[model samples]
Target: MDSQMNAPWSNCSIGYSCVKLFPPPMHTVPHSGEAQHRTSPGVEGRGRMKRGVQHRSNGRSARKTRPGSESGFEVAHDFGPAAESARHFDPARRGYTWGMIRFTLLSFLLAALLLAALTGCSRMRFVVDLVPADDGLTETVVHEDDDARWRSPKVALIDVTGLIADVRRPGLLTRGVNPVAEYVESLRRAEDDSRVKAIIVRINSPGGTVTASDVVYRETVRFRERSGKPVVVLMGDVAASGGYYLACAADRIVAHPTTVTGSIGVIMQTFNFSEGMRRIGIHADAIVSGEKKAAGSPFEPMEPEHRALLQNMVNEFYDNFITTVTTNRTGLSDEQINTITDGRVVTGRQAHELGLIDEVGDLYTAFDTAKELAGLPAARLVKYHRALQHVGSAYAESPTGSSSTQLNLMQLNLDGAAMHDQPNFFYLWDPTIFSAVR
Candidate 1:
């Protein structure tokens, strides 16, 4: 045979067909929520193969091949079904999801920390902690160790220095430390102690509100009567008006040689900004229920009738003041009381001359007087004292060594003026002290 003719197609060719006896059955690829089928047509007696992939919502896939038909011959022209377009996986999507979770957690943690800081700082802003004078009787000792048996009868000194004002508990945003309540507490302690034979109230104030002075006076009188322990008043640099009123409750009063005393009067005052308001081109309007309801309004001028109404009230308090002074100083004649009852500041010598005080002396002399009144030959002299709320530097004089605390008149007046935005009755030495400091 010739080479080309004798070959007779060594392998299967398009013209010379071959066939298998059996072909596998076709199968459909399974996909979630959907079904897809792939097929390929073939010539007679030739089997074709189809390929398909199942996809999931999670971006995962499985490969599958559909079996050829039940034909004897296999088709040569068939190719696997095109693979489902390869999906590009991005790493940023996973990173973004984790990042969102972290950011939310961090935001919550930061907010909680900020809230805690604010809460703590806000509470600290106006927290007024009061540490009592003598830490509430802890500082005083009646006697030394071996000499305890020989301790003398004690005389407790209660200082009524600075402003004799009422005490108020500290508020969330306002911190006010009060010495009056502490002083009163000290007196009560002295009253209950049998070893304490007497009490001396030392005054160094120019006076304060009428009600506060009366409260101190009343308490002193009650102490004297209840315990039968004499109370002697010792006047220092400035004890007048309300200070004097408290002194009148004492068994005897002793004043230093140049002590300023006796501004026996009541005063009520306020400001009228009508002229200033006009200059500033501002006006005020108030809706009131009655004509006298806005009695002390600073926006308008005070009428004569209003002045009379307030003066009458002041007169009543003055009369009470005069009666108290006269009643306390038993030997003072009405003429003598009237002579010095005017709001006149007097020296200790002049006060002695007018019989306003029992004696002209120093603090030691007053202590001796207290001992004599209480029938004690010698005694331990103790004064109740508080640590200074604010202290001067180490180089400055120690407040503990000082006889009394000096009040900031400007601050006191400003506080009073703003208390109710109205004028108040005072047993103060100088009404102008309540005037604008600047």
Candidate 2:
């Protein structure tokens, strides 16, 4: 008999008839071709142990019989219950994983549908309204309107507020609305509408870039000459410099009694970080094609020649401004023009005295003036407003239906660096306000 065998890992046993064979402990196995027989009382057999024997606590095993035995004999092995339980749990775990995946996918689809419905319901735009007074004068409501306002004569009101910039840098993501584009569109709309008898140019700005101011001024003049209609400027809290430049083109310029008007001049400013950089141990070398190309670079100090060159440009702009004012206010002498256009801000009353503006009046007075100039008894006031959409716009809000109409000072200061990051000239009132806080 071959009696070589491995000991049982667990407690188990196998037998034939009444001949039981219990599992042996480790380290006491018979060698190959050797016999280790334990004879029972009721059976007789010659047996040899095999390589692998195992046991279980329950005394059950996977059974197999040995062939050609003189008396019937067997072998078996058993693993513990821990291994059997793991096999039973696998299907339930697979089902739970798939169920969670389906739930997550369905949630995302529902959320998208809800967002789409809300977006469709929030569409808002503006219409010109005419509220008739008892005295037959039509009160101008430049905001939301019903169908009745369209029946009256209309005067398109275009707002020229906030900083005016000719921002044409390629690939630049502009934060707010472009005043030039918006103003031009309003003019075009007024030009096309036969019902619009006149235009009321509402101005509330401290002015901006030279080119941008000229653009608005030229456009207003051209629109007036081309359409054979009248334009009346209504000055708000502060309409100075380029704001006044736009007003110069109008048939009549009306200002509120407290309005600050006439800061008629040009300005150019640049910062030199050379000394600061030097203290911090930084040096930069420039390779340039021309000596004047980097004239106003903040990285280096401005040269005397560059200063002279820039001053000449400012003078040219100043002359152009003087010419515009003098030509418009035909009664103003050269000395009067020289006295008033000294970059000093004045009250609307002072401006009227200086011949810079026509009258000191309120917005309704401006409407009346526009009506008189256009020869219309009553006209409806129409203001252009941006349509509300899902994406946010950073432009200045219109006067009507808006709670706040002024730019935040802190935000403007923060954007100061970006506004003055490049070299440029301006037709502005105060350039120091846009300097970095430090």
TM-score for each prediction? 0.61, 0.62
User: How accurate locally is residue 436 in candidate 1, as Cα lDDT from 0 to 100?
Assistant: 55
Candidate 2 lDDT over 1-438, as tens digits, reads 222123333322322211123333222223242455453333343223443443223655533455665443344334335335533556667789999999998987676576557545334332223652222112234532243355777777777776666552221122344567768878887888888889889888777788889999999999998998899999988888888998999999999989998888988767788999999999877888999988888789999998898889999999999898888889888788788989999999998998888999987788778878888766666665644322222123452211112246552331232254666777777544544433
lDDT of each: 0.65, 0.67
> Candidate 2 has what TM-score?
0.62
Where does model 2 exceed 4 Å of error?
1-150, 168-175, 389-396, 399-418, 431-438
lDDT winner among the candidates?
2
Model 1 RMSD in angstroms: 18.6
Q: Which ten residues in a row have the lowest lDDT in candidate 1?
A: 1-10
After superposition, the stretches of candidate 1 with alpha carbons farther than 4 Å from their true spots are 1-135, 139-150, 168-176, 386-422, 431-438
